[model samples]
Target: MKKDLIYSLPVLLATACSDDAEPQSNNIQCIHPGEDLQAYYDLLTQNPQVVAAMNLCERPASFQTLLWDKVREAEKTGLPPDAPKPQSYYDFGLEMETKSLSGVSFDSNQYQKIEMVENAEYDFYFPAKDGEGRKLIISNQVLERATETFLRNQEEREPIKTIYTTKEEAQEIYAAHLAHSLWIEKNEKVPWSIIDYNSEQLGELFGTRTWFKTWDEKNDEYVISLVLDHSPRETWKVINDIVDLEDLTDQKAGVRGSAGYRYSE
Candidate 1:
């Protein structure tokens, strides 16, 4: 399904007890991938919620140090055998041109230029339309082309830096890295579908809906439920029966897996 769909689940909170304590809610706060980074960073310095979610003290320097330490650890151990590889960053830029029609005093001719900022590579162009109010449309077309080109080019690059190691460390880094990267990548048009659905697809192809859900940072693995709303129980059984057959097939031929679970009533 969609990453937004998985992210929409209710945040589960852990509770504590005390003799004179007020009732505590278990709502664990989470930061959306699209939230403003500077604001988030600043909030991390001031907000208890952000600090708790990141499992850090309310000090930015401390958090940075912790992250750097993890990076060094990953570099030393290498990523886990099954961890997804890291991606690279790409920058995008846009340019636009417009011309008024001759004698007609009407807007007509328009052109747009879009390129990757890093390599100065031109990727797309937009031309004007023919209509009574063509000038207005052409202007919009130019802006839209520029925006679209930027988004497309941005999608071609990886959203974060990653290193491989053991499954345990990989899991931790994956969760932490994804949490941060998701925020940075939101609305930037990078690949979200790839990170969220590969595992689910693999499960479906194998006809098995049950799989292990391991946190990227922790050793805990939970049994998660996976099924399309329209999927049948017999189909699931078939997948379960042939789960081992995956190794016999081309490793790269199947869909990737995701990290969350879903249930339907």
Candidate 2:
């Protein structure tokens, strides 16, 4: 009964929220990880629960304090049993990459106050498709952990070594790689008779990924990078490897991967 209840909870919650209620009309958004770190950081600074979540019952440290006290953890000391992991305090990227790409869950109105920044001055920098800006949908758990380290800065009053992605720079980065990239459009519909996307094809497996990572720099130490999330590769794959719908049912099923990135400060 417990197992059944647990299994049915996700479906129940999803069903309760969707089918009838218009998700789009309700100002409900799926915020992607790292979409607006600064804004989220501000929220973290103000929210006591979020601050306590990060502090984990220890002396509050700077945001740069990446990892947690593992030795203390082993000794069952310092942090309480429920503290978040260090990597958890940064980004959902590693989990997204490692976790099986089966479900496409997204963060909704739970963290709704994550303020977005847009201006006419940067109008020229906007991408051709969405002239306004971009939006990402992250999970609640991911958002909770991701903000801990960032919010620490507020408690410690640490200097913000923020690297704003400039319009010209953003435009330049977009043009250099993704401007002509194949994953910009939606893929053909997936067939219903599919099996598994990670089936072994000798050494290389088959799957659907709409995101990629690209390093950017002016040949210097200070380099700003962006992780083209799942939306970017909607059109195709890394090599634009679009499988035939008929072929999908045979061996290579659908393993859909989303895009995310690491914003180093």
Model 1 ranges with Cα > 4 A deviation: 1-40, 57-168, 175-182, 185-212, 215-265
TM-score of 2: 0.17
At residue 2, candidate 1 shows an lDDT of 21
lDDT of 2 by residue, 60-109 (tens): 12111211122122123321112222232123223433321111122342
For residues 138-233, write the lDDT of model 1, one tens digit per residue: 354555665565445534663112222344333333334423332322322223322243433423422212222322323433222231111122
Model 2 Cα displacement at 56 (Å)? 33
Clashes of each: 20, 13
Task: State each model's C-alpha RMSD to the native.
Answer: 21.0, 25.9
lDDT (CA) for every model shown?
Answer: 0.30, 0.26
On lDDT, the candidate that comes out on top is: 1
TM-score of each predicted structure versus truth:
0.20, 0.17
Best by TM-score: 1
